[model samples]
Target: MVKYFHNGLDHYFREGDLNKVLSLCLHRFEEHGDLGTEFFIYIENAILKNKEYVLQNLKNMPSDFALRGVVEYGLGCIAASEFRLESTIEHLRNAFSLSMKVLDVFENEHGFCKSVVPFIAKEAYNLKPYDNLKDEEILLPKIKFSKIEKETDFFVLASCNGIYFDRYFEEFYETIRQHNENNIYHIHIANPTSQTEKLIAELDDPNFKFSFENTNRGASYFACMRLFIARRLMENYNCGCLVSDIDVRWIKSPSKIWAGLNKADFGWYPKPGPAPSLLVHAQIIAFSKTQKAFEILEKSNQFLAYKLSEFPSWCLDQSSLFRAVCLTPEAKTQDFRETLGDIETVQRLPDTSLTEKQAFRAFENIEISMNSDGYPILSRVD
Candidate 1:
């Protein structure tokens, strides 16, 4: 079987025999554990060099065909490499809406394909979710999470680069600790500085846990990877999670937001706009403990991995979330802007330029807490 598959790789692909190629690829993947870099390179080269024949055959295949989606993604990769923006978006949107699971094969093909977050955001525009995809048909990255000694009903998740540790960590920590309504706070540190590691060690509170990733991918990459972290934490704690920006200050107990999960698998406030960033605010997003929610998180991780390889820009996190939402239409979601009104449940701290002292000073003499009606309102201190 292995010999037949190995010998037929070139003949099947050149002839645009997608099924035979996919079958052989899957057989190899199942047998050897992974198809590896060599397999992906061949597939990418076939798409890029034989673009017309490969894409025409892929396009002619039925929309429901998994190989069609995989090949279209390869085409998108080729278009992106050549800086063909429109074609990249068109092919990617089709690829996503058709069979996102199949594109996992290209997950390791960063060298062969080029992509940017803006192009991904453009593709997500008007993109529809995969129709009737079974849970078993999806492929998700396997990430390991540390066991939380004490599981809480809710968890607030965030990540930050080592650069912002001293300037923002204390204030961010104090605000959540003081205002938290029985929620566990876990922060993922990306490329932590000495001081960042020291402080987290000194704190040593079970309720305040820390995770670290030793990569110099900067703040945006760290931010984009938070959902994957959140997904892992959810698995460990067996609870709903609210992923937030480190710059956000909680006023009311996010239990109110947690309650919103009863109606949907995911919840976030969307700004009224057409742009991907504006479509979904990433400062605060609530994810329920449901398979649908897990699927969306995994899809977001997949999109993040693909786009970050190109090192686009800071707001790719939001764009990736938007793309995941577009691809997982069955994952019920709630827009908090509608239910919460213009109330201040949480507030963003000052811009990054401001020191922690300045950020705390901004809130001095002002108080925000939950009122009798369970709404967080701002009041002046006497």
Candidate 2:
């Protein structure tokens, strides 16, 4: 009976417009920053569009099963967006509880959507702790670094594979040198080989720090883990930290980003997409050295630690970052776009397979500099 009803619910979503409309709502919520009450109503209406039909078909099978559960979950998300904590908790409980039951029976089944259970469960658990945090405790005035006579004010940390070291490292280092303005750099390599370690050791730059991490669990796990590691690295220092991806090219100095920390504990570029997970890119994130920043990182780690020991690939760290932001009351965050020009950078070259020499030759005649308009420019030099 459970199997039959589950299959029926699947067919309903696949054949109906409700799923499509709901997806559209999720995507557009972050895309347009249109989290108005009307937007919430639109989402609620879409979820309920075929709810009656779905509930009728699944009647007597299991209460609050399948599409009914989805409706609850959708409502919970809307409640969360609207800051209706009580309603959000109640709806999510119903939705995630039902989801767990469904997964217990069908998780091993072929082609089952196994990720949903873990994802929903994580959200449910994380929100509980979030609910317990007091508004006063979560929101606090931003802390500033004292004026110390240090060579560098802050450091940029990045993670990457050793294979791309030669492909992008030089250009990456050069760009940072251009805009570093006395800031340091830290590179975390994922399981570097002996040769990779040796090569990195040859660099005589005192301003750069390097570390290797065990990324066997994959990128998502490493992403979340890096936050904890970063927090530890900043413990003794009175400075801000910027976490970046190695493939990124620094077009503008992060000084503007660092200055943003004066008003907030966290700073980042929010990519247009769904909230909580796909809402922001983890590419470049600035964290000020403060109790608030540490608390947020600690909370983020706690959420991942309670992931039932299963790392679901549904933007694990990104979702946790969002939850951390939400959990912190009045979490002061500055969007880099507010002060800096487009934070976008060319992530990778068109042909990634190019050899290091080939890559160097390719960029030899191209100059990476700012145009008169103050925008980063890449132009061929004759």
Candidate 3:
């Protein structure tokens, strides 16, 4: 979610009636964001509407078998709606526990009705994390939440037409070394031009995985490759692959970014520029190849896949990347969003008191350099 707010969610929050949105979501799955979100919003809104869903759920539950766990979880909402009273204590306890685990999946979402789990956790069970809540909790219960479910390990595929951004390459490689694990892999897909061949060769030290793909289709072509990469990674590595823009420079240690991203199914950051709202950028993106990232990725990708090569070829490569991530695939994404955790970029610049307004200014006047274990330009700097 954007700090300032102005994008899709912002518009709805501002213009749409909250009560109406909730009412529709309760009765229909297609009324809200996506299927997952529809379920979440439905429950949360239902509680706001009547508190009966939560009460009904308390009366009935499921047997141990295999069905749409999401659907079963949806049924659990019936119990969730009655979170406050001390009577359904066992039911409320389970409601909070279950939603707590999946809270990140749906809570505090923007742009779309994507925040299914979080929404249910919030209104029905009065859930939501401490930081996220408007009213802080007193006499807070100790939350021994286990963890968010893991999706597929996301493999970042970065490519360029002739000259690759050596700075980004170094940083990306470094990000992998610093943050990657068995669940996370960094893959670079590029076709550098001859002009930078000498400089490209100068980028030594190898821990990177490279692949060849044609670079003639302009920037949007990368989007197409990302879908292919996601398909390939899911099929071969049992994960999803994201199309990354090498231009994203790390402002902090990539490990921290990866850690936060691990909590979500898919990962995407907003662009630095201005728009009607805080627009998300695809420079650093991960496909929901794993179960987790898929929701996030699909939410972002759905809008992007159709709008191709709309910006500066390389500069706008990611513009559409996040949009494509919003779309849902045929198969259910496996939960790996945090499995290996996110292998993302992080910046290591010293924290400062003053904030810069410009987007790219953070790295301006700074020389792009590297350390051991190739880093992405968006990774830590020494």
Candidate 4:
């Protein structure tokens, strides 16, 4: 039976059959031995189904095994799912330390053991919640916008406080209009103040329509609000949507680039890193009006809500976006930089002298550029 299971497992793994691999791994564990492989399989299944069960299994793991670090990591994931922030951090920190120790022991060991440390470390780091802001109340207004009179190819959704709107909206609107004059832009602002309203009314281009809602002042509110708007645009208008941070600038016409992304359900510029480690920047994302994209957005909305309720952080949106991308098999993403050029953040280009033309020139010349974030300094780039 062991020989039979081994042969079957080898075949399933070779054929890239996930369900079969999981099933066989679980069955193999039922017969004893292969505890490490069993733990991984159990945790993977628990992530999708019963996290409490995974926690119980992890607690039962023997103390001396090298993969006990993985058990701690599983505990961290379970804690995160339960919204136990302190427990989550403690478990993940232990996971990181234990994984490092295991890596040291396997310094000369190649293949699978060598691969484990990086995976453990990265997952542990990613699972750690961003700095807690200690605020969790729904601040967004309940009012909804009626259908607009003009037809639009797409919509851009963003949220900001009064300070950001005052500082950035003019340049953001101007740059977008300069590049995408032909397309109608439905710009929705969440938590708009009187100053923002005045600015929107003054900018009153027929091609640009503004909608506003008042929301609580926090990163979670803004992130969830963006998700809300994205769903509404996709459902009501049945059109493609581009959700961007207020600080993001369109150096070139985004319409053409968006049109070119026919192969993907959604597209975003990835943060620069190794391919497997790369995460999509939530600041600027274009989603096609497909069921797959809609489902991803919907799931992301729920995920952001849960994460915010537990530990509010600026990264909740992007982290939720990353998880949504990972979980949704049908949701395909493309590198938006390939079409529209790389994003530039103020952190990367601190010198104020770099004109918009110079920035575009750099992107066109294949120079490195930073992706957009909530940084106020990025909006100051003229």
Work out the TM-score per prediction.
Answer: 0.55, 0.58, 0.37, 0.55
Candidate with the greatest lDDT versus the true structure: 1
TM-score of 2: 0.58
lDDT per residue for candidate 1 within 54-159, as digits (tens), equals 5455555555543454556566655544434456567766554443344455455332122221223233432323333333232232444656666667788888
Q: What is the C-alpha lDDT profile of model 2 across 307-326, one tens digit per residue?
A: 41432333556666766776
Error in Å for residue 235 of model 3: 3.7
Which pairs of residues collide in candidate 4?
A: 139-215, 139-216, 140-215
Ranking by lDDT: 1, 4, 2, 3
Tens-digit lDDT track for model 4 on 298-361? 6666656555554443345665666677668667777677766666621122233445435223
How many residue pairs clash (N, CA or C atoms closer than 3 angstroms) in each of the candidate models, in the order given? 0, 0, 65, 3
lDDT of 2 at 96: 57
Residue pairs with backbone atoms closer than 3 Å in model 2 (clashes): none
Please, what's the RMSD in Å of model 2?
15.6
Number of the predicted model whose TM-score against the real structure is largest: 2
Model 1 regions more than 4 Å off: 1-146, 149-151, 351-382
lDDT of 3 at 232: 45
Whose lDDT is higher: candidate 2's or candidate 3's?
Answer: 2
Error of 4 at 249 (Å): 2.4
RMSD of each: 20.1, 15.6, 20.4, 14.7
List ranges where model 4 is wrong by over 4 Å.
1-143, 149-151, 273-278, 344-382
